[model samples]
Target: MQAQAFAPRLIAWQALNGRHDLPWQVNDPYRVWLSEIMLQQTQVSSVLEYYPRFVTRFPDVQQLAAAPQEEVLALWSGLGYYSRARNLHRAARMVVDAFGGRFPETREALETLPGVGRSTAAAIAAFAFNARETILDGNVKRVLTRVFGVEGWPGERNVEKALWTLAESLLPEDAASMPAYTQALMDLGATCCTRVRPACTRCPFAADCVAHQQARTAELPAARPKKVQPTRYATLLLACHGGRVLLERRPPAGVWGGLMSLPELPAGELSEAWLAQLGTGEVLPAWPEFVHVFTHFKLVITPQPVEVDALAPRAADDTRQWLTPEAAIEAGVPTPVRRLLEALSSGTLSVSHQIST
Candidate 1:
């Protein structure tokens, strides 16, 4: 393969066919970085809805850094992977404190910031600084694997190292072409070289692609080894009083970390201490059980709705709050917690005093 010839072809194809109208296509590093973080494991359609709203709220690094973590989590409520939001907040503060509110220009310098890995730094540098950096994101990995007919799971350390070396070797020599070339690789992978049912006929490299030529597109870029994801269980206390539900802030690190959620208990059981602490309350019939899947395990949640007359003064403190069901849904709650709140607000999961007895 002629390494020098690849960039020009990709650049030309990008000019005519690549995405240009994305909201974050500009030269601003802040917007580029924000879009990249949000785009991680999330679809463009979802980012499109979120990016504008997030930017409008925070506007810049300074604004984001100045905002409270709760506000940040609230804005990122529905977006899975809450840690990204936490890291983004930390990175924003670092940009303000360490870089004097301006993003570092070089990829190496950008990597010092939290959550900015090698590929992410490369993308930020290429897009914002026009630096000649190479990115090997999932899309690019797929494209390279198929184009070169590279075997083995891309997640393997050796395979990833080879892909990185290959990616760096393919970098466009002229720094001026960095943005277009980088975008071209991404656009090609996203639009034409899709994981399933690739549009090989429309691909610029279709004629020369090894996988296309050998009819082994499906076989190359081996899938990750599968394992059975284990399941866990927890019970959420949906204590309601005066049209408000109780919520507790999660610890700083773990599953759904730093987000507000329903107070949890051991599955299939309730704590007598919690009942006594919430003053006189009737533990109504438990709501339907549901499952919230994480990357590592499945969380089977049983929501126990309780109608309390009044809360003890200590029950609702800094760690916990009583907010209207609608307001609680608007808070920094997880998706599953949000669903439960919505159900409570809409009377979809109601329990009467009669139902309790």
Candidate 2:
């Protein structure tokens, strides 16, 4: 298909078949920005549940900027990648301070925000401001890769550069079409050109898609090179006292940053030394070990539930709290931690007999 024909065809298709009722489709950049951040590495269905609640809690840039980071993190709980929420909070304050609570209209200026990257900035600009900016998000990457038959993993620097070039080449000449055009690219890739078992016949690009024509749909977007993922082991201390669990705020960086989590004991740490902070407690049977996979490594977590008569006075500090499982679930805990809390609150804690190596 001619580069000139791409935008018009996509825009037409999107007008009729694209998702139109998403809560964030409003022209307000704040809503657009929130949806964009929440949608990162998250499914639309998940965002559908969180986005409305988020907007209802913090309606605008000024409101989000003024809200406490803890509230922001709490609202963002269960949405993995807590850094996005942290950056979002920081970015909201930055926008309030730097731009008088208004989102920058241009993509270049928008990229300067904490969590808003190139594609995010472009989408915000195009959808919110009708700016003619090209977006090369994951969906667009997949679409371009298969339709153009681009070889090599998109994560590779050189391959990404080529995809960006192709993306820029297909931008709608009219700025007015930017929103529809960008959404079309995303919708096409997400709904039709899925990563697995794509609906080739339903795709508008089926006639011109190199992957479909060449029968290489499965292999067109090359997969990432494999590597042996290393596992890190830790014991999560689920110390219980009077029906409340001891939780600590993780440091503001690294895994589960700035979120409340069960106190962790690394593999080589001494139990007696670690217990010095928590005082004496009766150790219960260990829960079944489970693996939480990160992007680069696997975290082998063993939940060690302990029945403590009382916590050390020093244990309850600004960074630590003893909350009922009900309250902890509502706090900013990681997904795995939340699951454990849910099981504990629901009175379904089953001790696993055989621990995985």
Candidate 3:
């Protein structure tokens, strides 16, 4: 199939079938960029819940740029991928400072923003400026690899380069249709050519799709090779005094960056030492071990509660705080940590009712 022929059919199909009413599909670059960043490694359904709230709160680039990072992270608490929130804040500031509070119309300028890669930059250019640029996000990659039967894992450099070339070649000459064309590719993959159980019968490209013809729709876009995710252990100190739990702000990088969490004792360190470091207290019975999985590793968390007469003193520069369970829940703690706090606040946990001497 000629690369030129792909867009017309996609555009026509999108006219009737593509998503036209997503919250961020409007002509605003701020909304488009926000949606794109939130959609990274996240699903449309999930993004839908967060997008409108974010837009209502921030509304525009200038407002988002000026909002405090804690406020932004609080709004983004359950969205996962903490770095996206951080980068979105940084990028908004950059746009305000460097571009005078306007998103750059060109892909090149957009790409310079934090977390805006080539594909994301291209998306903003097409949707916001109607620029004739190609996007090769995961959905597009799946759709193209199946239609064109490009083999090998899309994560590989060579495989990705080939897909990029294919993506660029398929761009329609008429720049006016760029938004529809780009959206068509995304919708086709998301709704029709899905990762599992693709509805090929409903796919617009099924007739000429090489993977369909060869009955290899399941095989063309190779999966990433699997490796065992390593497990790590940590003990979190749930120091409580006057109904408040001790929370520490993690550094603004790495896992759960910039989020408030329970104080952590070093791996393999005794709970006694952490308790002594704070004040005299007895360790409560441990909560059931819980696991939090990251992209590359699994964290086995042991939460130990300590009842203290007074919270430990902190240096003037410390990020630690003692907030009531209600307050901690409102803070930007991760999902699992939030669950623990909620349990404590609700008195559903046995340990919270009984203070160990």
Top candidate (lDDT): 1
Q: lDDT tens string, model 2, 303-357? A: 8888887866744366888899989888879988887887788776763433232
Query: Tens digits of per-residue lDDT for model 1 on 213-270?
Result: 9998887789998777798989999998888888888888988888888998965688
By TM-score, how accurate is candidate 3? 0.64
Error of 1 at 341 (Å): 50
Off by over 4 Å in 2: 228-357
For model 2, where is the 10-residue window of minimal lDDT? 348-357
Q: What global local distance difference test value does model 2 have?
A: 0.88
Q: Sorted on lDDT, highest at the top, how do the candidates line up?
A: 1, 2, 3
Residue 306 lDDT in candidate 3: 75
Superposed Cα deviation of residue 82, candidate 1 (Å): 0.6
TM-score per prediction, in order, is: 0.64, 0.64, 0.64
